[model samples]
Target: MKKLIKKNIVIATHEYATGFPQHLRSYLSDHSSGNVLYIHHPLHPELREGIGSGYEWNSGKKRISSRSTRPVTAFGIAFFMKSLFLDIWWTLKSGKRWDAYIGVNNLNALAGVVLQKFGMVKKSIYYTVDFIPHRFSNTFLNAMYLWIDKLCVKQCDETWILSPRIREGRHRVLHIPSSYDRKQIEVPEGIWLSRIKQAPFSSVSPHTGVFVGVLLERMGLQLVLQAMPKILKKIPDFRLIVIGKGAYEHELKRLITQLGIQKSVECKGYVEKFSDVEKIVARCAVGFAPYTTEKSGLTYFADPAKTKTYLGCSVPVVMTNMFHNACDIE
Candidate 1:
């Protein structure tokens, strides 16, 4: 057997516990030869140091404790402003030139480009998860976001997108033509080998379903709750297990109580590992991913990661036609 050659690689993304970043890390660990450094931008302003908050750093197999960010507002404007600067600053301070620098979101991608400018990174990759023009409510902020997105697309050495529709949308909406075609656009899709191994056989709960995704309103989780009352009438012992956390979690719980389905539905908050999610989902009869079809939402363009995870678990997935893979699901 030949020995694997190591590459110095770094990744920057928001500390969201979404499967994408973790999957990226796990995928590289298994296939690529590299020393990986992962950095995160905290979503909330009140992230603490020791609580395993998403803002911490992990390099290779070792976990490195990082200092906490100062508080301000939700989504923390300061974090957004400083994320790119710090990525470059940290790279320069390391006194090392990275073989590849991958940034998950547009802001992080911009950091990768800036690192390349400073000669700190050999290659800069723009790994965009989703793209929507009206992502922010503020007009100025939304415009700025779009500008940064276009800049990253033009500047980065490579752009890794989730779906092909996103590629079309960028050209149609942003008027940015694809220069390299196949070389420029790449889709890194695949669950881990264990997920590919398929979940173990278990006693399926016929009247029970599981939800393992973000709790965002556009994710359409509330619709399932609204319809659950009717579902309860059919299967009196019907149950729903909701795993994952997001902005809509409070509203979801409130709606559950409002619908008087508290005993019927269980909110498991956030699960740290997809394997743990599989443990809960594999035992269920079906999985749910009722995302909305709103044009301004990420669901309209990108395939839902939760739905893919559910499919990997070998459980039936009930999803809306708002995502890219809806037509293919059948």
Candidate 2:
């Protein structure tokens, strides 16, 4: 038997201890022999205790959670700049030469480019999980984000996209010639290793549905609220469990109140633990991922994590037709 050699890897991401990056960190820690340095954002006071505070390093697992000490609005330009600088500084100051540098978003991808350019990293991989151009409200910001995104895709050794639609858009629509290879890796919201073990808990109730993702207007949550009355007419006890928070939260709450379905709807806000999310999904009869068809809509050209999480927990999913893989569900 031959022992596999470990490769040194560094990951730069803005999301701190959540989503695909967290899953990737766990995977690398368990699989690799070399140390994995995860550069993440600062934690909130609640998340600052027990495995959340400071750096968490196991026998071979090492992570560096760094960012601006001052409070900044989440996903704002200031936050992005602060996170970028911290990641760049730590990546350079680590002293250890990384075999592979992986960046999870646009800002981190730019940092990865700098690391590669400066010879600090042998190879750079851009893990583009979302399209950022449509995320910005300002035109100049959107244009700037697109430019940086293109540069990262063109210069990185490998580009890993979350969906096939994004790849098509990059090649045929965008016509951005990539100097490197591109791969589509669909990273689900939460990993489910033992579906059978969890299946027994996934009891279906026709009157209940679950929506487990960011509560954004682009997510077509309004449509869900609009249809709630119709759903209630058919199933009087129809309940909607919303298990995430975002910019559209206030609007969603107002709509729920206006529609008089507030009693039937339960907003769980944000669940930090993936296990807790799965447990909630398991009890629901169906899952909702009603992404819109707008140009900025994520489902128009991406694999939604909520859809996968629903199916992973053996709950039937109700999503829009725009989702590329939605037809395959039946």
Candidate 3:
């Protein structure tokens, strides 16, 4: 057995959501028996500000509803600058040499690369948390990200990834395939049973599936809406209850009406608690992930928090092959 190195650690990543970081934190909180330091770049307040159940997809409830300045051109610059300042401030104040500085997101990794320059932090590990090159919001952003990605792999001492596809693509990226360990998610038995007992079943039908996650573009909510009518025809009671909100929620609602599945589907936007999702998932017979091939860059390369949450709740899932480690269904 390889002896694990016990040391002080700093985990840098994006803010909380019903996404990767939330699940990662659930696991890493007790990881390796070492003191864990969490450092995050300031995320939009609209994205945070909720607890259990309310965040289980869109619950049709508005949580925080505050908008932040989303500057496209200067996003990277601003994010890097702010995160760099926070990181340096935290590390200096701690006055301790970090045994390992792990980046849970690409930008955070880049910040670590910046920290490694002072020649004090040892073993800066970059986690290729999502598919970057293919998921950039714009062309220029994509170009800049590609360069930053190169720096992360080239400049960091170790790199960690969640998928074989990403690892294979970045063969020169000098990283270990640490596919975001999935063994740590544990909902307390009392809470789990209570949520399951409290779950509200849909009268629509049994063939319908529920999708619970942030309603983002790359996640393929559009495809789910597009496929709803077809799925309804073939599988009656095949409604989709979308839980969560994002940049594409309004357009998705429009598409829902345009597709005429308004009665069949519900857009429960932004529940303030995850316990709501717990109930929603508990009642759901099947979890849906209709991520399309071309738009599946991030979905294909990263470990989805939704999939784990679904399985954790004993709900079988239907996800695309775009996701890695997806089990073969009978």
Candidate whose TM-score is highest: 1
Model 1, 1-330: lDDT tens digits are 012226677788876555567666766566555566667665433432233222333444555445444443444455577777777766676677888888988988988988899898999988878888688899888888889988988888888888877787788778887773453474735565565545455577888999877678898999899999999998999999998777778898899989999999998877766677777877888889888779767877686777776777778889888877787875
lDDT of 1: 0.75
lDDT of each: 0.75, 0.71, 0.60
RMSD of each: 3.3, 4.0, 8.4
Candidate 2 lDDT score at position 316: 87
User: What CA RMSD would candidate 1 show?
Assistant: 3.3
Candidate 2 lDDT over residue span 116-195, tens digit each? 88898988888877663376779898778888888888888877877677776666545675433334444434555563
Better of 1 and 3 by lDDT: 1
Model 3 Cα shift for residue 153 (angstroms): 1.7
Per-residue lDDT, model 2, residue 249, is 86
Over all chains combined, what TM-score does candidate 3 have?
A: 0.71
> Could you give candidate 3's per-residue lDDT for residues 1-330 as a string of tens digits?
012224556677655454444544444443445444556554544554431111111111212222233322333566556665666556555556676777766677876776677654676887766654455678787777777776676677776666655665544332423342231121211123333443444532366578887777777878878887888888866667788878778789889889888988877876766767866776777887767675336776666667766766667788776666665431
RMSD of 2: 4.0
Off by over 4 Å in 3: 1-6, 16-24, 27-34, 42-76, 135-140, 171-208, 230-238, 272-276, 326-330
What's the true lDDT of residue 33 in model 1? 54
